[model samples]
Target: MRLPGLILIVLATLVPVIWFAPLAGERDAVALFSQYLGASALILMGINQFLATRVAGIETIFGSLDRIYILHKWLGVVALVAMGLHDIIDAEMNGLRGGPLSGIAEDIGEVSLYGLLILILASVITFIPYHLWKWSHRLIGVFFLMGAFHYFFIEKPFSNFEPLGLYISAFCILGIVSYVWMSLLRPMTPRGHVYEVDLVRRVGGLTELVLLPKGRGMKHKPGQFAFLSINDGALGEEHPFTLSGAPAQDRSLRFSIKDLGDYTKRLHKTVEPGMEALVCGPYGHFSMPKGRDPQIWIGAGVGITPFLAFAESLRTADAGPVKLYYCVREQDDVPYAVELENIAEAVPNLELVIVNSAEGIRLTADRIAGDLDGDLSTAHVFFCGPVAMRKALKTDLVLKGMRASRFHFEEFEMRTGIGLRVLAAWLWDRGVYELEKRNSALRQPAE
Candidate 1:
């Protein structure tokens, strides 16, 4: 089965356990429950990683999939909160605070502390835009391992009755073990392409890099991304980066990055050729053609990276005709400027329009339509950029009466579980409100 399908299934099966946890017991039950929540969240993260590598052309949502991305991230947040509550109650209930250094309570307390630390680290790292936070964020994988250990040995929630309790507990622990083993220890090279940094250069205000695989072709479709890591750093953390080059006919891959944070800043001053990098992925659904008709690509700033890959692929007859209306703050902000035009020249169907806003050039979808000659409604718009710009474009598309199936975007959400739960809860609340409104209207005397 595809990784996305498998991951979603695992998560869906586990969701019921957490949902029913409150009914199993009292306050301690809630605390006990939190550990499982964390376990589930970590597992989902692993699932997402697996999906990125194993699934092809699979998206989290059918329409503009930002909703799924948000859900995944928020679910991680919920898991964090649950772990916090788990620690507090477990500490107080077991008198763990008073235990000796080597006692069970101390170990549990230490584990809880570590879990909290992981949450803090992941949350903090996510705040930085793209490449800066990208590399270091891979450390969360280590924390996920720590959390799994904490889940099983921390509280020993097996102290319950009936078959389902122990059965589910064992299932959860097994899942955690499998996820951790696959994530940190296992390597995905498999006799094909292993990643290596080709060149790291200073372009405009950013440090951009070119990546190529070692000994094998780094095969991927256009509009996909790969995770990156520098092996030589004090903190060898991996981050996801969108492919910025045309899809390789020979399996070579390329990436462009900017120094948006501490990780990239170091890359600017330090990263070099011949050094190895851990690259995992080619994930995301920001692609142009995906069982759809003509596509429209919307971009801003470095978000244009993936679209450049799409356009490049179109240039080489890699896929199909894809029209691009890329937005940038200034003419200079567009990466691979000459290459983008060169490809457009080679492929007549691939139209590239640059809105130079540095001196105040304004643009919208209406302006974008002038560049292409086709049924605009048939085009599925793909976007990757700052959150403000992304949201604005989505709103614009909505106002244009574009169908949901005709829009797509990518936001590399850092977390993965709580958002879905919250969205579900919110939806539940709205349903309740509508029912209440109808009830009140029915109660009123008819005029």
Candidate 2:
């Protein structure tokens, strides 16, 4: 977890306690604690919305969107737990309540809780299609608004909780503001660079798109990704993809997208040369450092895209010994395999280790540990692959005395839109990834 995000979560959890501790002695103990729980959850949720904003400062502090998403996920779980505790503890208070407004408030709170649960669950389960999941995510703002209504109108032990009520109200307002900006305003804003589709190739089961900027191109480092939205019949939905090649003077960009879902499946057929697209950002920090020790690069299937960029960046440099472990089910499944081989042959310090699971070759941590000729402690390991692979390798390597900080990976699996459809697609892809990994593992050569 990023230090700033961790700090924010700690403060958000503790500040509410600090604010309400003085009033604890004046009110019923259980009632005051429940109110405090609810208040802290709301504050955390507001901070959650803020962190989701792709602000430069937050991204820098959080290190990358990958870490940001992790913090975002944990905060959501904490908020939900807090809200659940609040509901249970406050359930008996309704029997002693005396007004119509209080009953209405209780009803609103109940509804918000249920709605939030559904939305968060949809987000957690990636099997939900992206289109439906996208909509489900947006409904959170509606639930938050209702929660704010409940907070303001409800009968409370600390009804006169001074500016605390006002503070929560501000959070509610900001939550709505962030929802509007992300779902509406951000998409409407023109991209930093507009590109014409120079070429679209269907290779294996993936679509390779080549983009040529129409005006001044956005400068980006290798291994970073960009969001692309085609103006053709493809709904103009922006999708993040890693740059598959080094920075060039022509400012041409290439994205190798695997046909995992509906959007990508139709990409080759729907997108054509001369088509225009809005390109925003070269986001992410999945790159190697210049002064670091030998690098261990791992890429599985389409995850090889970033490694291609990294290899391109290292072509002219005399970096220390680097080994790339490229994994795929078959020779044909490896994207950019030929180009990668050519680059590896040209760079003396770079070595390519191709692992074809079809032939019972597996790229496990123990296998890598055995293959390395030098001390593993001084090597920086970078991975871009399925979440399961990353987790397994990271765990196994860490247990073998490798520092966790020496391992890094990028997570492109994100809740992009505020809809259930998007969620479903993400979930569906995640399920497929896990299944593929399992099938591949079953084919591995036994030790």
* TM-score for each of the candidates: 0.66, 0.86
Instruction: Highest TM-score: give the candidate number.
Output: 2
RMSD per prediction, one decimal? Answer: 9.6, 7.6
Please provide, for model 1 over 1-447, each residue's C-alpha lDDT reduced to its tens digit, 9 standing for 90 to 100.
235654554665476475447545743655546545554544454444333233334454322234344444444455455555555554323422121323554465456456545654455443345544434445555555555444444434343233434544554455455455555555553222466777877666666667676766566777777767777854266666777777665666777777666676776777888787766665655666645366677677777778777776664464445666666665444566677888888887677777667868766655555544524666677877666666776677666656665677776443433244567779999999999999999999988
Q: Best lDDT goes to which candidate?
A: 2
Where does candidate 1 stray beyond 4 Å? 1-72, 81-162, 178-184, 187-192, 195-202, 206-208, 234-236, 290-292, 318-321, 331-334, 369-375, 412-447
Model 2, 1-447: lDDT tens per residue? Answer: 568768866775676566677866666678788888888778778777777667667777766776677677767777888899998885344333235687798899999988887787677776789878767777887787788778777876444346665666677677767777776787677546899999888766678888998998878888899878898766387777888878888888988889878777667668889999888787888878877488899999888889888899887765888999988997455667788899988998889988999898888778777776535787889999887789999999887767898998898676532345676789999999999999999999999
Worst 10 residues of 2 by lDDT: 90-99
Residue runs of model 2 more than 4 Å from their true location after superposition: 91-103, 157-161, 190-192, 331-333, 415-447
